[model samples]
Target: MADLPELPATITVDLDTPLKRGDDAIATLTFRRPTTVVLLDMSLIQLGLVDMDVMRDLLTRTSTVGLIGEEVDKIDGADMLQIARDVSDFFQIEEFEDLEIHIDGDIVTIPLVKPIVRGETTLDELRLRRPDSGSFRSLSLARIGQMETRSLAGLLPRISMSPLTEADTYAAEPGKQRGSLHAFLVASICTLARPGAIVDINVAPDRQQWWPGSPLIDLNPHGRTQNKKHRALVPVLPALDRWLRAEYATYIALSQQDRAGRGWLVNYHGRPIQDVDRAWDTMLTNLELPKGREWRSYLLRHSLATLARNRGATKWDLEGFMGHSDGSQTEVYAIGEFPSVVTALEGIVADMERLAPGAMHRSRTEHGLVGQLSKGDENVS
Candidate 1:
């Protein structure tokens, strides 16, 4: 057996500003463990070095025997694990014989045996394998179960709701020329739901006509493609349909004067029209759904993709519907090619229209709003 590297006497700790309470500061500590170094490097890459600085400070300050409580509030579990691996690596330790982590509310106590590293390859294997037996495995299993339950719970509400009413369906129709634009938006989102494909939208041109007076949706404000400024819409077709229809009705009701001053739709005097974000929020809130922002975005795209998948659409078909490039690489490697993507979208839209014909109806009937007061007390006076 190869001898292990010597353990460092003290480890470096870092703390964030928010955790800088007088006596109790939250800190993260990283030691010289090989496994830890590997994990920390990955985390640093993911979070960026700038973000890791505060964490590094907190860890260094808390490593002392008596100062752990004084220098830290609550150690981050992920950070601590990464630090432990780093410490193991630095000391050339291998095979974590006995390591125990106990969590009680905000407090966590980790007791680990010193590792003895053999060679680089052996050390790599040790880091990848399970640290010990029993408790860790059981705890991990329990955590997985809890996460699965939470995910299932999040999906339940949306699945159980009944289809929208006919009157509501008809209220979403844009004029003849704009109908295709709405379809394109819905189709693009459906395309994204497939396994792997990049989607981009050119909103500037559309925004000019669709939102004349509104601020331009800038694509390159920071000169970085990865920045949030260039985020493209890949809305789930069903959700987009639901959202767009609602917005159209709300906008039309509030905007009274149509293109030719033809009072075609019933006007709501004083009711605030639904903006994009507000419309999405209202729909999710009404359904009492709980999903993180990113997951919600994925769900929106997934909803459309799922529809396309169900219709037996070719992947290439779906891609075309989404306005994606139909290059050879895309045809061979992309999950949702044009054919499949388009069919799924068309099928979903047709199903939704069939089930909820009123979804496209924008006209407000007297029966739809019996006692609801008009905006600005217009009906009251």
Candidate 2:
């Protein structure tokens, strides 16, 4: 009333349709007050660009916000987030938690929290998340390309989900044949999900059907229930074969003892391993995870499956490779075709070689791979 003009009661902005990035962007917002309706013209950073200076200017309650920047319109995500944050802060609209900040592209809306009721003020857990990498970006073709670029050594530290079950911890006894068998089990688990999913040494007597040198390993012969039991020659790399052979050697040695054992693989000292949980824990510990971090046994499978999906693995390929049963009244087996899974796994192996050189090193010291292979936890690398 003394010397200043009255501010607008309401403001409505008109940004160009289909917000894009560029330099020659011009935007206007109309401010309507009881006295008069004023038009405020502002230069926009091109292609839907927004910057800090622009944000600051817009926040000001004066006509000076219409000034154009002397520099090029180089707006980015940081700028946009800052502006959104400022707007939210200024508005302080806590009741309507509909505000979201993201770089628009190939968008996916996951149902994270469901509302309690349809329209009433009932609310659910408020959560916000954005995709860092994946098909969420329009230009990104291979969403899993991020994972495929990582080395086994590098991926080791990133695995957050640890052993989920208490029963998975205390697996077996420290037998004489423990070391070699442990190596065999560790190698097996790393290659696929559950040991039985790949090759239930206990169930499949005819596991070595794909020849000695071939990378493919067919664990399930012909059954509707067993690990989706089909024979499509799932690709098992040389690294896996090396471990399999080591395991077989132990199993064969144990066979000579004429002792009935549960595991198909034996130890270097000609003894059978009794516990799966023990072997899993011992192996993960050697992987050098943070002390006391529960190492999930199914992590390798998850990694394999995730990478495979990222590389465009089909449901058929995934189902076959994972031996997933559809829970049908009578088990129905899809034609065993796992080409995509194999391809994805190959790429993963190649990436591992590039990222972590000598991630898998097998050596024969004076003690050989015995006693060392006993506790089931060795430097599996």
Candidate 3:
């Protein structure tokens, strides 16, 4: 963290060449290190243009290079050495020797000296000192213009799937009311008699029927809706029935207070029974959710479409079930516009009946006779 040393006002350049009176020789001297500024001072004896006092003053003034002085002050010793090496490489100079540096706090002192052999100077050693200047380079206009026409090519289609698992259907301490609701919805869809048929549900009607005066009915009258027109075309496995019923039971039990309190799951003081976000967080912490809502919705729709396709359902039939508008663009332009809960539940029931003839009947019988009566136990500590 030490500050960089400052450059001296001038520098002395030693050359192997001797100069005649009034004869000007430009010596191109290379630096042993990287510096922002380079100073070159002519020897008084060689130039024969000034006295020793002037020459001594010039040498003292040229002792430090100003260009890299600031940078050196800010950087550590290791970085300074590295920068020096880099600068040396840029100059492409070999056999540079007799490098000496003196530092007194922030001030740098450099003394330039050359060997004298029999009072004769070698001309080959004479050179002007030039510091390598680094500056920012801007891109040309032509390159920027060319970039405008560049287009992305060959985008890969992304597909995703999210199947409801046993853990979702039967969590020991159900996380959120929404989670239970979602579980119930998925379960109900699975229980439909038609394995490959589209199931639709309207949240409004279903909520009204399930809990007539609940505040939730007013909040979201539409029952759980589905994209029936977009067929997933996947086969409805038999295991879906049990899963759906379990989810349904859990959802009903959790929302039972809301049902009794005229459709609002909140307490009399209007405080929420549980935080929805916290519930969702719990689910996220325990389960792997689809990346985003669009992806999840697509996965659900795709599953239905795939199932329908496998069941010998025509494109039009699939589209109708999915509530898509009729046209050539049905596959691309058309998406589920109206998701009806009643229609969906009916379809699900029918499918369930087809898959397991006695399952729905037994569930109704058990739920009506015993399930409803024991529901109170759920809210007990």
Candidate 4:
């Protein structure tokens, strides 16, 4: 085993398998300190860093020159494992040396940065403010169990002096506070998809499973792309449609190789975005969320499902829209497009708009997104 590198360290590794980026065949990767939360969503530290998926995720988050999932996948197996081992060494070598946790009754505080306070009464910390049972005034048992957004949104404004206003307590802060692309990603997940399903979407005019003309997105479950039979038609509500148009226009303009390449809809320099952990973390930071309140993009899926159900969408409707029924017999024997899916999605979008006015607005025009209208496509309204 090699010695662990020092804090804020750098290490370069020659890749056994080079990646193709335009005319360049990149053959090396230099990793740097993972500047953000290394594993915010990982609850069981006991699982360790040996897992390939976890290591791949960490590598993407920490890479100095930046790497997309596709690029990371091309890394040699031996090299990848060694990189993971190096990461484990760098992060876990000195376990208790620089660790700190403070608990005060219901509040648990963790300060990532030093507080610069010139005056009196300055405490540098981020703490959780737990709400007592009294916080659930008019909220019913059923609504709470269902995780209804509207009810929870209504309740959150009362919990803090500074209530979260984006989607009540559900979403991050307003789109204006963060870049429009960030807001677009958040809103897209909350309204139309599981994060991976949308993030991996390919929008090349000829290659995509569906197009702007289609009201439904034929989402291939992220890791199961090889299984062609398994796909779900997720509804594109009005708000989601606007976002798709904007993103599509931007994607085309940037990747003039429109007829070639994978055509990943959400990309960095035309490369597919395989994971969004870093983006999610960045959004949370912009929101100034308390340290302990880290959120995953998957939660937006939950919010959409619960919000739709609360607004009277049937289980089948949600199942169809969310790809929950993908591998089941429903996909083969009796899988017809469900009108209720559209209705349910529309309800969720309406609720989002009503709860936080203009929360779903397209703010990415400056990024060259055209938000184009369809040319009388039968599938789109």
Top TM-score: which candidate number?
4
What is the per-residue lDDT of model 4 for residues 277-319, given as tens digits with 9 covering 90 to 100?
Answer: 6655654565555333324556656655654554456677677
Q: What is the lDDT of residue 371 in candidate 2?
A: 45
> Over the full model, what C-alpha lDDT does candidate 3 score relative to the true structure?
0.31
The weakest ten consecutive residues by lDDT in model 1 span 121-130
How do all the candidates rank in terms of lDDT, highest first?
4, 2, 1, 3
lDDT of every model, 2 decimals: 0.34, 0.39, 0.31, 0.54
Model 4 bad stretches (over 4 Å): 1-192, 221-231, 251-259, 290-294, 336-341, 366-373, 376-381
Taking the tens digit of each residue's C-alpha lDDT, what string does model 2 give over 152-264? 22232222112211111222223332444344433443345464443343311334433334455655544534434332345666656555545543344444335344234
Model with the higher TM-score, candidate 1 or 3: 1
Cα-lDDT of candidate 4: 0.54
RMSD of each: 20.3, 16.6, 26.2, 21.1
The reply for model 3, stretches above 4 Å from the true place, is 1-162, 166-285, 288-299, 325-381
Question: What tens digits encode model 1's per-residue C-alpha lDDT throughout 1-381?
Answer: 334344565565453332444675545433432233223322332222333444344344434433344343345555554554454344342444444455433223333344324322111111111112211322343433443333323222222112222112322554422232232234334335221122222112222211212222221113334332223223234334333333333334443343222211112232222222333344445443443564343345555544344345555454444434333454346433244444445444444444445443322323222222122111211
1 or 3, which is superior by lDDT? 1
Superposed Cα deviation of residue 350, candidate 1 (Å): 1.6
TM-score of 4: 0.47
In the range 1-381, model 3's lDDT, one tens digit per residue, is 122233322223433442222364423222342221221222213223333333233323332432233322433445334333433242332333444445433223343233212212221121111111110012223432332111100000101111222223323233333433343334334422221221221122244422221211111124334443333222232334333233234344444455333322211222223323344345544554433553232244454455334333455555544445223455356433223322333343444343334433312223542354335333311
